[model samples]
Target chain A: MSTYSVSDTTAPAAPRAALTFSNLSGRYGVGLAASLVWLAFGLSCLYWPDLGDWSRTGSLGIGAIVIAAFILFGTFSADYLGSAGQALRKRAPWLLAFGAFVTLWEVATAKFAWLPLPFFPPPQSILEVYTDDLPKLLDSVFASIKLQLGGYIIGATVGFITGVSIGWSQKIGYWVHPVLRFIGPLPATAWLPIAFFTFPSSWSASTFLIALATGFPVTVLTWSGVASVSSAYYDVARTLGAKPSFLVLKVAIPAALPHVFVGLFMGLGSSFAVLVVAEMIGVKAGLGWYLQWAQGWAAYANMYAALIVMSLLCSGAITLLFRTRDRLLVWQKGVVKW
Target chain B: MVVQSAAEAIIYPAVGAELDIDGVSHAFDIDGATLPVLDNVNLSIAPGEFVALLGPSGCGKSTLLRLVAGLEKPRTGSLREDEVRITGPHPSRVVVFQDPTLFPWRSVWDNVALGLEAQGILKTQRHRVDAVIELVGLSSFRNAYPHQLSGGMAQRVALARALVNDPKILVLDEPLGKLDSLTRIAMQAELVALWQRKGFTTLLVTHDVEEALVLANRVIVLSDRPARIKADIAVARPYPRHRGDPYLADLRKQILGLLGLEATW
Candidate 1:
């Protein structure tokens, strides 16, 4: 029996002692450096005289204290932190750099008024926007989320179906492929003028734009994905007594999924871009609307805050899609990693 | 040792299908030029007989096997299974290609169960999936995806996938051609053992004369391009036959002579 050995996945033997003096210094050195930098910068913010009125000095001190406390906990239970702790320990330099950047951003913008007033509000003023407009921000977040989800789901579903149809059937491809080629290249926002007139409501018009944006990439990729599937699989399935539907649904679809995911990624990127533009279509409450509203009043801090929120929201959606792709495409593990 | 549960899962033993090919001719359109491959090839394979089709490279032996598998229709004549003409691919006759062709997304068990699932018999014959996996000595890799498997293991999965269907006729288009010499030898023995156990009619297309002599009950040698039946040599030896037998050696010499190769060994 010429069997290959299966890899053993048991955790490496734990350190003999719970706490070791040698590794304590080795692991905690960078963490200690980060803590010291944050603590020093935080104290300076409290005591040092500011050129201008930067009101969030107190919060800076508190943020520093929180990070310091986490480092202290990490030092005591390195084993308990496990992989996350190990990552934090390894990324101590980058973390320290980030803290330094925040401290500099505060000093240069808010305290010193270096870059000029309305254009460059301090990080503290941005934080203050969160505190001052908590309710409005929450409403905007909810509304934005509702809009994003509605548009994304509709777009992705329609795109996937259209792609599979066009990819699988030559007849469908012959008719729909030319349309996809012509219209797919056009940006989703380009239809804004016509959409405003065509759709019954701005919401449907906006939704339609997002779907159009998402559907193109998905359709194109899916077509290629389906077209590129090795004919060997169909031959195998056919000889196995598989019906035509089974060949498409089971073999063709699963085989083409990796490519479909690539299209989904493209679609997601375009969806976000289109979502922000679509929200500018007289929507009552969304981050995009709020951004425009705040900018009109010259509350640049509020605009900055909205922009930050949008970044996080889009990133969160992308991360969620990645997780789904990972789960579904488990067979492709290790072959591709992001 | 067979798992009793797995053995119980398989309800039917493979009943070999008799194949009759009468005046079968095939061709291909290569760059808009008609390239004749097979010309009036005829053969009748008895039920449970293991026949090996031997030929030179580009001899169109694989095309012959593909015609039998019903993957392609012969241009001239008919291929019949017990007097019933084979128009298209049927579960009763399966071809194992040179490539393993296991679905990259599917696990070994899933690949083996594909045939049954395709026929909507997976619910009743699910256990046979495990049995076939075990038979291929891949029980531990049942959940492992195709990409994780070695070439030999992948080929075994392909074999198991075809065998689990209990195909009456099994076509091998140089299925073991890509394997390393050592694995190929081991697989040849395993193939013979499998054939003896299941008693399915086998048509193997190969360029390896020694391999043809080792496993086949009858060897059909084919001529190159516009492939004609050159020779049909029957081996009178029984199962577990010796490779170094004087008669086999003489037949090997004669086969080489017909192939226009002098016996240098």
Candidate 2:
């Protein structure tokens, strides 16, 4: 009756909104600027008389690749400053940059053999290698995705479910908690030999490794989540005569979801990181395996391309998972609706 | 009107004979020494009686309220509601605490509806939520969160939540003790209006002598720790009783004198 009025939510717009071209302008412009400076530096370095051990051409090619990586990262990070807009920063500029730079790279390497390798292919030849052997690359990519899917599913699901169960009640916690505390701290790769020996199959080994990697965090997050509900809330629920199952389903799970999802995102990322490394060990089909194979014979540019593709896939998966979290917790964005 | 209210009070002298606390006593160990809380307390509150237990802090006033709400049990004597021994918390008896205690995660409407939802009357219970929201003057802020509300509004939300459950008895554990004077006075006025309309039995615990005198038909005063009922005086004042009224002033002086804090007042 004597109630004061309450105000509505006032969620501030994030500084960098989705798909804004502001980051590209920053990342690429800064990158281009750095590349120009580096180019000048390399040209200046080329005139040194004592630079006979390493040829100027090879040094320039390697320096260009390293500078590109540095400048790309630099420009990209700066793009987020005025990042509030939602329009797709136009991709044409990025595409043109990628194309023109790569073409120059290919011509320099192929025509002049700027950076030569005995048993390995240069990037120009490697670009043609794709045209000549698209089937091989596709096969490897497909095999990797397939392995990743199975391993990711097994690892994430069991980890999440078991984590929640262990977190929710003391009984399971007593049984599983201490064991996980010790075992969970060990790196996932440590389990590879054991898994490979037990399973006798490369896929199972990778899946086991991946599950081991991601499961520990989920269990810990879920444990913390379930423990975090205010005892006052439990009293309220109990006073209301809620069943144990109802309490868990309604009060416990909903309260724990934000934490649970955080664990899930971490697990998803770990799975990607472990994917390539796992493949190179036992399996023959993932991006990791392809990178290793390309690197084996000193195919530096080919190795770099494979690395780039792997990075794209990894980033894409992570982005998708985060978007899923956004969809689930859109309310957390401070946009509450009546 | 005084004669009529007096007659009505006589007819239902005790809380219509529903709730009974029999010879209850409690204690807490402070500094490795046992300190008495409530001793030989015997009272019965029937349906629809708004009683205020007024006392100083450590007088076991809130402890007694908690006993009645079934949040705590007395060691010496049994407590009963409608002749049935009270044990754990029951939704039929809801409590409004001094602090707002509104769930931060829940919206205003959601917080109000939580008790009812817990009662399992969720779907097709439109009237319950709407009526309670209207009762508290928070229909406009039904979707607002506790963090977004002023302290006064949040307290009202807490009251609405208890009321929505249609509890047989409402317990106020120093519900308005934390409020500033202006807001507290306004809230007291509003409380009387709502109580008259709803007719739910209430037990308000407070240290404010004026508040106890204002809201309650009978204000039960208790002595300091190892509390005993010092006095039980029936009030004849009507709603919106003026602070400047000579009668209220005399009563205030009388209470302060009784509390042995006459020099301070």
Candidate 3:
């Protein structure tokens, strides 16, 4: 707390100048250098004759603008953004590397045509596909979202309740657990023929397929979570005057939530896989159906575009799940590194 | 049904129940082998008295505390409170274990309010949660989760949780043994202070002789396996008793002698 005067300590060394861009050398300035290279590549793409059927000037111009924006925003507002800005600045080099990759990809496929045909379509072809089929793509996206949500909700809920009941009572567990174990390892897709025959419509059949895929992991993990709850917790709750219901609902369920989240993540992954296959079976309008239609026509560009969308959608669902886990398990804060 | 408020039901400044252990004996079947834990452990604790059950580690001190807490019924005898036999665990008596065992999902305040909520009185007695949190010096961390607390802080939350229920008897099973030395000393003082203020009948099971001497009015020393009361020495000293007092020094020596250990001090 106390500050002491430095009594003219030792001989005063030569005064150093301020830390300016002149002093910032080597890797410290790599981000700026990379951005310049990206800009130069973008400029060349505009003037050079294209070997591809489509002109890539617009998309290349957009990419250059984005890189410029990042450079300007990162340099000027790095102070205002505080820690987030610092993080962005640290990751700037990765963006530069990505830009280099994009430049190489553009040259090889679009301008030079060095890669094989159809298999390696240029970035512009993918962009062209997005521009041409935006409306149909939107429709498929919504359809996929609806199917995934309905199936996931039904599966996760039923799985959670079943898991909790099985975990809570030995009598119920004795009958159900072994049955679940036998059925669990069998692939959900193995039920595809039965599901098609049993359901009245293709919609219901597809939904069942997704649900079956999602439910297994959730049920197994939730069962393990509930079963593994410490007896100490029950004892404490009992001594505190908790009833059977309170012990199960409040104590057991909450204590087992972390495990339940793990199950949800696994379920989400399998559900997506099942969703695609189910759509390919009988579904009319979804990313999976679109992929099938695109492949049948040999519109590889559209297939690539749909694959990107599917990947984004699936990752978005997973990100949402992670956020929910983070929110609910506030007590596990700082214990798990992201 | 007409319900009486907590204030009207519990008599403050002297709320503890008289505990009567009628020749209680208990054992556990460890892999089909009957392991004797306690042997005819007859003891009677007066109302509002502080009694410490002292024995070596693995001597069934915790088992005795559990029995008194009504978590486990004794094999051979009945344990009573205020002339009524204890059938099962009741909120009237609460146990604070050495591990704190605070629920990881709940915040400090919610953990303390658990008993009140269980008894269906939380809606009416919500204010006691803050009061108890403050009592345990966890007011600043009322909303903080259990994982966020230090060992000492977590133990305080456990203490607050037990106290919030206005329990008639407080059974502590070496609650402060896991803490660091400095925290242990501070918590011993805090425990005595709380007992004096709340006037709950305290049955503390501990292995530390100095802790028993410092906290309890009557220290009941027990022998090794199949724990039976070897000596029940009553300390006539008042609250805030001196650690270096000659009387406490002599008592510690005698307790050590009974435990088959030399008085190294």
Provide TM-scores for the models.
0.94, 0.73, 0.91
Residue B261 CA displacement from its true place in model 3, Å? 1.7
- Which 10 residues in a row give candidate 3 chain A its minimum summed lDDT? A1-10
lDDT computed for candidate 3? 0.84
lDDT (C-alpha) at residue B234 in model 3: 98
- Most accurate candidate by lDDT: 1
Task: DockQ for every model, please.
Answer: 0.57, 0.25, 0.42
Q: In model 3, which runs have C-alpha deviations exceeding 4 angstroms?
A: A1-28, A55-88, A335-338, B1-13, B263-265
lDDT of 3 by residue, B109-171 (tens): 889999999889999888888777777777768888877789999999999899888889999
lDDT on C-alpha atoms for all candidate structures: 0.85, 0.71, 0.84
- The best-first sequence of candidates by DockQ reads 1, 3, 2
Q: Give the alpha carbon lDDT tens digit for every residue of B43-124 in model 2.
A: 8776777898988887888788778878788989988877889997887778888877676667788888887677677776
Error of 1 at A235 (Å): 0.6
CA RMSD of each candidate after superposition: 2.9, 8.9, 6.4
| Interface quality of candidate 1 as DockQ | 0.57
Q: For candidate 1, what is the total of clashing residue pairs? A: 0
Query: How well docked is model 3, in DockQ terms?
Result: 0.42
TM-score of 2: 0.73
